[model samples]
Target: MSAFLADRDSARFELRFQSLFNAGHVVSFPCNAAGQVDLDALSERERDRYLYARAVVGGVFSLPQKQRRLD
Candidate 1:
């Protein structure tokens, strides 16, 4: 793999879509430092959630935030 792709694959960051009305509700996906998600790397269910989160950004969720993974 290219260095860029390899770096993204090993990223320890996530893109978090926080619910606007719910303080504790969030949908997150593994992502690189720039908040780029690798759709091909996600499972079927996860891909669906990611798409859903993107679709409802203003209505159901806040703008996505890039966060470092603790684990």
Candidate 2:
């Protein structure tokens, strides 16, 4: 793996997509500090969700927010 991927693997972060219409609904994926997700690290279902989230930004979901994992 490249250095970038290696650094990301050790970080605990998430890219969160909050629903534009819903108050508490959120979709999140594992990501690096810069909000970059490793598609190869996700399962098939998760990969699909990630792509869907990207497609719906600004329509169904607001812009993604990068946050460090609390746990």
Candidate 3:
């Protein structure tokens, strides 16, 4: 979905990731703010925050802070 990724960028990324894997490189998966690794199991609040974060990272949103301001 456009909410997550565009097909072209997504496809390119998949190819790159596959190449890395084929070359025996390990890709570090994404983790949440609390360092949780599972995405599909995220709670409602965590899911919302995660989507906002994904949007920011993918250049779909500008949240101002370069790093998360979690103090």
Total backbone collisions, model 2: 0
Q: Residue 23's C-alpha lDDT in candidate 2? A: 69
TM-score of each: 0.87, 0.86, 0.28
Query: What lDDT score goes with residue 46 in model 3?
Result: 64
lDDT of 1 by residue, 1-71 (tens): 43544884447998999999999999888887778888888889999999999999999999999999888
Residue 46 Cα positional deviation in candidate 3, in Å, after optimal superposition: 0.1
> What residue pairs clash in candidate 3, if any at all?
none
Off-target runs (Cα >4 Å) in candidate 2 are 1-5, 8-10
Q: List the residue pairs that clash in candidate 2.
A: none
lDDT of 1 at 54: 98
Give the range of the ten consecutive residues with the poorest summed lDDT in model 1.
1-10
How well is each residue in 1-71 modelled by candidate 3, as lDDT tens digits? 33233223322221111121233631222333433335554567766765555554424433222223222
- Which structure among the candidates has the greatest lDDT? 2
Off by over 4 Å in 1: 1-5
